[model samples]
Target: MHAHFYAIVNQHAGNYRGYKIWQQIQEYMIQKDVRLSVLLSAYPGAPEDLAYDLASSLPDKESDVVVLAFGGDGTLHEVLNGLIEAKRHFPLPLAYIPAGSGNDFARGAGLKSASHWKQGLLDLLQTTHAQVINIGSYQLQENQPRRFFMNSFGIGFDGSVLKRANQSSYKNLLNHVGLGAISYLIAAVFTIFQTKGFPAKIHGLDLTKSYAKAYLMIVTNHPYFGGGIKVAPDAKLHESNLKFVLFQRHHLGQIIFDMLAIIFGGFQYHMKAVDNTLLTHDFTIEVNSGQTAQVDGKSIDQENYRVHFSKSSYPFWLPETINKKR
Candidate 1:
């Protein structure tokens, strides 16, 4: 069990659960005699800066520290950016408590909290089995080489949806109305109506292919996105590869049916018109003209980008054995 814990919290996360979850985690850790440090992100880029500082200053002995992220995938994404900026070859392990809307990474990582958070903490503490999960890295064709992503990145329709979702004042209200899936639903509907799709050429794996027009192109290192939607059912974190799912131009009915299939977790194979495949290492995506790209949830102003896969053998400890043994 890790004796020391540090948490970087996004206070404005889904329904304001970030602080509440952090307090609960703190109480639980105290009960187990674990030392903890809590840092609340007051504004947008705070957590990333703090996390980078911490990662850069990690002790020489690789101090027993674990970072608990108390927000959605965006928070996790920021923490990852900070860690990468810190340039730690072997960064501290990450522990996630899904407190934000669209906790996609948490669902994909299988670390969603149960009815009680103490159980989650105990599970992390008691587990022994470990795995080294692969994280995808991407660089925009228009931007410098400083930016990369650890989660799913997208272009075209999905990126546009992300833009709207981030700007919607009704996002929180919708999340409260449902299990954080409402915002995505609303966004998807809007995107379907507004987008005619875009053109892109994608080369990956044995699937080096081109698209005359695509509704969206999503590159996932893990299975789920937009909360629990399994965008690519076959993507595995431990697998040394990436998965690409492209929705070609479709009619409104096809779009609606494909969205339904995605919600049901078999859209890739179920939708005959969908292009879904895996890439071993490198891939390039070029759009016809102007296109928006998004890494994690941040939108990038770019028309093209090249993704090169590399391995970061970070040690990840999980409760897989205990949870799966049942």
Candidate 2:
């Protein structure tokens, strides 16, 4: 029962260290006598196209192929979308190696540290232990193409933070020093004073509500976001439900306090600022015109979106030892 490993490497991710890590992984595979191949992503969204082509070429029945994503959460997001687009009902088994600045998905999934990820990946490739996790989907309109996310989706405050951080020189500097999470915190502080609340309406699975001035709306599939912040402490990846956390228009001090709470694992104590926290299988958010949004830390230029949470069509391989610990 040999496995065919294909890694989709993101060359631009994580302080320009992807190529070096890929080389190490290739050498390790050679030493272990395992089959290995790689597809380098040349540009944004290239992983999706490559994943689609690879998945489409597979035989109808299950095979020994395993797709490994060697980038940040965004790379995994693109690859997942590509495989789902190729075959909605039965995508290939997937694995991941954290190699990006904000690896919230890896943290939430309890993956090994970056220094030890090669051994963790090798362990998965050598066995068939896999888990079925849920994926979140959203569309701006009923007729629009659906976008998938393996982590959290954010609007207003979170979107602004990501936009600012991506455009700032600090993020790159932080990445180089292996302190990428601090970049997001700095961006959030800068954006907090400048951001304004926007009107929003949320229609959840069991409740519907409206807000005249909403500062933040985060929908999460797991407990971590913004590089290991436990924003949704109770979220489970295997559950077919989405957890929503909303922060209405609040004072700068309150916002800062909440941010600190999230950073220091004290979010439960600051739940007063949270306008609503609910679990729903499906929901829709209508934001004021000109507002922004983000899906899995990537900014989106949209004011409205309908989100649906459901189990993934395929399973993903995880290191058995790590899975047991979780």
Best by TM-score, which number? 2
Clash number for every model? 0, 0
lDDT by residue for model 2 (48-129), tens: 9999998888775767778888888889999988888886345578888888877888887787645676776667766665
TM-score of each: 0.89, 0.92
lDDT of 1 by residue, 247-313 (tens): 8876778777777888765746756679887777676766756777677766666544564443343
Instruction: Give stretches of model 2 more than 4 Å off.
Output: 303-313, 324-326
Error of 1 at 22 (Å): 1.9
Q: Rate the local accuracy (lDDT) of all candidates.
A: 0.71, 0.77
